[model samples]
Target: MKKRSSVLTLFLSVIMMLSLLSACAGNGNNAPDATNSGNKGSSNSGSELKKDTITALLPPVSANYQARFTDMEKEFNALYPHLTLKIEPASWEDMTQKLDTQVNAGSPPDIAWVGSTGISKYAALNVLIDLNAALSDEVKADYDEVAMKYFQLGNSQYGLPAYLAIHSIGGNKQFLEKAGIDWKNVQQNGWTYDQFRDAISKGVVKNDKGETTQYGFVFATSGVTSKDYLGIMAKSAGLPDYFDKNLKFSYTSKNFLGLLEAIRQMIDDGSMPKELSSIDAGKRWNMFLTGQTMITGKGLASFENSARLNNEKIKANDGSAVADSIEAEYIALPTPTFNGADYIPTAVVDGYIALRGKKDPSEEHIKNIGLAINFLSSGSIAANYSNELFLSPITESARNAAVLEQYPRNEENVKADQIMMSKAVPARTDIPTDLAAEALKIETEVIVPKLQALLANEISPQKMYDAVKAAAIKSFGEDGIVVD
Candidate 1:
């Protein structure tokens, strides 16, 4: 997490703004415990019988985030008493640097929770096992196109989301009344680019001293998911993709360059903090919490978290119920659409979860992954995990009107999920599984740098796109790299 300025420390002011964004585990193949083999073990027909322990890796805890999985772990162990499931928590940084290491050593944990930052990298690397054979018919049937398609890679299903959420407009009715803005007017008029841009302009005000004391909308680094904040706009505009169909790097796409420029333009226009394009995500959110920033990209839980932090004064007219804990007030926004042939970037409701290997995968490992995945998706377990984790259900039953009414906090989330569901285009799942990460490195380490140069006015979007395309083709080939 990044540090924030003093303003984010406030409780009441937080309620004045916030419209923002958005856990889980299962065991994999290995034996319940791997370390204790020799003393009570015997070799079978001169073939060494090896045992492995099942574990899940995640980043360090941060306000209710890690708790989602830790809660699931407790329940999972209790339900399946014979399994010895262990959680290996560390900084996401550690997982980023160490995942390949453990996997290369042939001792990676059986199951793991991953986020956008690392999923593409690992999926390309093929460190995670193929999940196609393991998915139960019932489980496969339960998923909507978004979850089923998003985590796929080439021919394999490497991961699956627990749910789907969207990032969109958020507003506080009280703030609107005070500012003489019409809340009903905006929603009824529909969220157009012009309307959204104007709302922010109308909302911002500077005091006599030249300090902005109140802002109409807030979009900080914290206001959106760090993983694909820019990707959303690109999706809206119908660009190709930043990544290849295999979840690997294809950063040279016209789609990606176009999206990056939009984000850069937003920063340039002052709708977002100039520094926001540079700040880390946690720091950005902390700013929202303290009222340093108000309007944010609202996904599944941002509003909920904001509601928890705001005071009654802040909650005045926001539709969602975060008034008490959230220091700010907010309402769900219709996800803005792109003008071109694209859709909004599809975000997995579940960041990502996949089966890793203790060694090479086997029938036993496949069974464990299947059973764990099926049980995890079962409706009986869905309510606990979904509710506690603040997730949308992939199953239609969970999305049924009755269940949604029972969980009103989930209504905004569900609606956002619908937006993602309706507009999201499918991710191509055709890259060779093993090459996933080399592809990602091409995007992050290679393409992003070139893009920064291009966005700084040093080059054209076409030039940047072409350069990236050339490199990708040099590295991955035509079928492997699609630049649109």
Candidate 2:
């Protein structure tokens, strides 16, 4: 999936909450029970392997990356015969709808991927398999810690981190140099909302008549989180997730209102324009690529694509010409946070789960499942994935050691992605669905809007925040979706 500059898309990736944990540490809410009776029918533990078909589900496909995943399925089938795994593709566009349809139809895949955002709903509806009893500890350690927290109830495991998709800032370097902006300082100091606004405000260019020649910010909505960018900010701000003690949800909050007020402030300062509000990610991206904009927050793929398009050294495996050809030097940098919160790197983990059921839990079954995941998580898999499509590996070891040597991207012959991990607001796994969405809603609708109003000289950010908190509580209590 292409990472959008908007914040809601970040949560959309987490909609499944795979490879996740609660933002709150060791709340004792998601650890599995010792008895762990979820994996039933463990009769087949012999050396002779048995054959069972397992289905895996993955997130939406990008047109650029579709062929890459197809090659993965082919390789998996070629290597493993005793355990046949089928992959079903679902785009982020209608993920929750399709997932709900599958559950209603009683045709759940044995092991599948989902969004952290919707994990609470699935857990509430009892639609997943508990893998705590099945997986060994050694295998568990390879997972992203936040992803581990994403797949539990009171306590138990549901999924592993297949691949992670994270976010950062992307911009046209030519424009940056023209604007006299220093990306190095921005990266080192970790730009806050105020700093982000100041950068954009000075960078936005206008003609003598005050006619705008360039915009500083743009939006990338994808199919999820159409207009909300607060989801992206909340994770970075060290803000608590929306779930309450009972895990109920609401749509307004003081923190979120404060954030919105901040963004609106940017608008008032002539940093981010209101004209870019519509849900046209492609247009916004194209604008940025063409140097019509100076900055926008997005994921690695866009930065890679942007960089690859500009570098004469970059080319496809087939010796074919690349699209969107241009000479732009840009890198994906850590997105800004409010105040001084640390960076919280998050991604949509394409996870799989084996449900507790009538089927025999034979040794072959466990072995097969383990092997499938191993292959998927292996360096070879990353190689195939990177070659076929521009994908980053899930493991630090693979990303750091093998990938750069195996297949380098861009001119620097830069090896695989070294996703600089930080201890930001840790992921929240135990939280319920309604609570998460509702809480996110408050950030976008209630908080950000007020911030925008403040920027427009409508109200003070502090006042907007104070007033919105009471309203947020009311919405969550009366209108927000409540789960758990």
In lDDT terms, which candidate is top?
Answer: 2
What is the TM-score of each predicted model, taking all chains together? 0.68, 0.69
lDDT of 2 by residue, 175-281 (tens): 77677777655555557776777777777889999977777765554335443355566656554455534554422434455565665666666766665444355
- After superposing all C-alphas onto the true structure, candidate 1 shows an RMSD in angstroms of 18.2
**Candidates' C-alpha lDDT:** 0.52, 0.54
Candidate 1: count the clashes: 40
Question: Where in model 2 is the C-alpha error above 4 Å?
Answer: 1-50, 60-65, 68-71, 144-147, 225-228, 238-240, 243-253, 310-326, 339-350, 353-374, 383-392, 396-420, 429-484
The TM-score that candidate 2 achieves is 0.69
User: What's the residue-level lDDT of 157 in candidate 1?
Assistant: 69
- What shift in Å separates residue 431 of candidate 2 from its native position after superposition? 3.8
